[model samples]
Target: MTKIIDGKAVAKKVNDQTAEAVTELVAQGVQPGIAVIIVGEDPASQIYVRNKNRKALKLGMHSVVRQLPVTTTQEELLAIIAEYNADRSIHGILVQSPLPKQINEPLITRAIDPKKDVDGFHPENVGKLITNYPGHYPVANTPRGIMTMLKEYNVELAGKTAVVIGRSTIVGKPMAALLTNANATVTLAHSRTRHLKAVAKTADILVVATGITHLINGADIKPGATVIDVGMDRDENGKLTGDVDFDSAQDVAGLITPVPGGVGPMTIATLMQTTVELAKWSDAK
Candidate 1:
């Protein structure tokens, strides 16, 4: 029988830890706060922001959301970001992705104060991650959460062969870096890779994040390999799906995470955790 990786359960554990951290900080008279900025009304981004706010508030953190109109100019957005940067009480700031076309996305990301850039998209933070800088390096939410889950499960990485399918900065590249740092032999495959099937079969751990629905089937996974599916796609029937065909891959995979209840919940939980960390770090100053 294939072991189903319970991402929901793991995320709940993270949430509980975050809540406890919040309580501890509050007892010390430090209230962690997160500022979430959303430009335009993209439905997916709206849903993500709403969930983040709800979870942050539930964990006793201050959740502030700044909603800007689609017509808002670049200067207006930068001014708002500057305000958040100077606000001593705001520990973390996240400008949701897919900003209006008029806005320069990279410029907005760089404008965030490095210490408060909880999303880890700023050049300073990215540089730290790239260089494996000493101290606690702030990683992107999803990658951090995925690492947390792996640790909680006691999965060994040393001397292991791992394959990551995706090259996106947000998940794939970071994931490969993390795995390699743990002494694992990491192979990163992308859409352009030749003999993809042969490449995927050579792994003790396989992560699928290609974004295309059902891009991976049972044959793509080596038997008894642990699989992590990071892509979230909606099928024509409006059901949430992942890059891997879960039903088929399960027969071969030793462990797997489900679509909706898996990595999805962990992302925000990790974000909240990062927010709390930022608050504590800032409070020490």
Candidate 2:
């Protein structure tokens, strides 16, 4: 029988710890604040930011959302970021992705104060993650959440074979770094990789995040492997699906995370959890 990794349960545990941290910080005369900036009316982005805001407030952390028009200029966006950068009350800041074409997303990421980059997309944070920085640093939320899930489930990493399918900066690249840092031999694979299934079969742990619906199935999975699907793609029938075929893959995997209930919840959980930590780190200095 496949052991289903309960991401929601793990996320609740993480959020509970964060709530306590928030309470402690408040007692210390500091309320952790997260400023979420969003541009345009992207329905998906709006929902994501709203969820983050709601969770932050539920955990008793200070939360703010700044909604900008789609036509907002680069200079205008930078000015708002500058305001947050200088504001001592704002402990962490996140700019939702898929910004309007006129705005440069990477430029905005660089403009944020590294200390307050909750999204962990800042070059400084990415560099820190790649180099295995000795001190505290934020990581991209999804990957961070995935790692938390892995730990909570006690999935062995040291000397294990882990294959991460996809190479996006946000999830794939950072995920491989984390697994490797944990002493797993990591293989980062993508669309161009030849004999992809053969490479996948070699993994004791497999993570798929290619944004392709049902891109992987049981045949691609090693029997008794741990499968983590990071995709939230929609199938032809307009139903939410993951990169891996859950029905078939689950039968083959020793442990597997489901589509909606899996890695999705962990992303926001890590965000709020890391926000609390950032506040502590900032206040400690």
| Candidate number with greatest lDDT | 2
Candidate 2: deviation at residue 146, Å? 0.8
List, residue by residue over 37-113, the lDDT tens digit for candidate 1. Answer: 99999999999899999999999998899999999899999999999999987899999988889999999988998
Model 2 C-alpha lDDT per residue in residues 68-158, reported as the tens digit of each score: 9999999999999999998888899999988999998899999999999998989999999999999998999999999999998899999
TM-score of 1: 0.97
Error of 1 at 85 (Å): 0.7
Model 1, which residues run further than 4 Å from truth?
283-285
As for candidate 1, its clashing pairs are none
lDDT (Cα) of model 2: 0.94
What TM-score goes with each of the models? 0.97, 0.98
Decoy 2 TM-score against native: 0.98
Residue 157 local lDDT, model 1: 86
